[model samples]
Target: MAFTNEQIAVLEGAIASGILTVRYADRTVTYQSLKEMRITLRQMRGEMAAQVPGRPRARRTIRLYQSGSGNV
Candidate 1:
């Protein structure tokens, strides 16, 4: 997710010339400038990562039924 200074400069040029755009399945986004694009990309990446499945829940120690009885 990190970009070198040279790469950033190149992207900045492309953005200034309207060559770079953010595209999703349903729509496209045009950034005002490279700085905005970088910010937007970072936010999008965070959102995508957050949507990924997380670790399973830990097992519970307490049981509802004990010694075949209905109540604890």
Candidate 2:
């Protein structure tokens, strides 16, 4: 699906406000700020839900890890 300019702007703003983080190189990198990753993900999920019919929607939650966290 294509996002409009306005929608993109809103997403960008959310990212800037610390609502989402795009990860790369095994490190968390915020699109706008450290805390915005969650917010952006929420917004994106909402947008996706609205555009896609008959799909299950899920709520957003935070998962925290201490230093030296490892994947199973």
Candidate 3:
């Protein structure tokens, strides 16, 4: 499931507070300590960040001018 900004904030807070176990559906993930949780969170955040859509690039038009050339 995708996490909202608020939810991600809450998760970050919980990790800071040493609360590791996260439940989703019928599954649970428990980290050994805040350090482990931080590492996991960093990985998750990196993956999520990579998944975000970026702005489309603008198209460039190149104009070539010929000097004293009137060739059709």
- The number of the candidate with the highest TM-score is 3
Model 1 agreement with the true structure over 1-72: per-residue lDDT tens digits: 433444445545556676767444455656676678778556555554555688444456965654665676
Candidate 2 local lDDT, 19-58, one digit each (tens)? 5644433545446554455565566567766778887667
- Best-matching candidate per lDDT: 3
Query: lDDT values of the candidates?
Result: 0.57, 0.57, 0.69
Candidate 1 has a TM-score of 0.40
Could you tell me how far off, in angstroms, the CA of residue 25 lies in candidate 3 after the best superposition?
2.4
Q: What is the TM-score of each candidate against the true structure?
A: 0.40, 0.31, 0.53
The reply for model 1, stretches above 4 Å from the true place, is 1-28, 55-72
In model 1, what lDDT does residue 39 have? 80
Q: lDDT tens string, model 3, 1-72?
A: 454565456568777676788765566767688887777677667656766789344468999988886876
Worst 10 residues of 3 by lDDT: 1-10
**Model 3: residues with Cα > 4 Å off, grouped in runs:** 1-10, 55-72
| Predictions: Cα RMSD each | 13.0, 13.8, 11.7
Q: How many steric clashes does model 1 contain? A: 0
Candidate 3 CA-lDDT value: 0.69
Stretch of 10 with least lDDT, candidate 1: 1-10
Q: For candidate 2, what is the TM-score?
A: 0.31
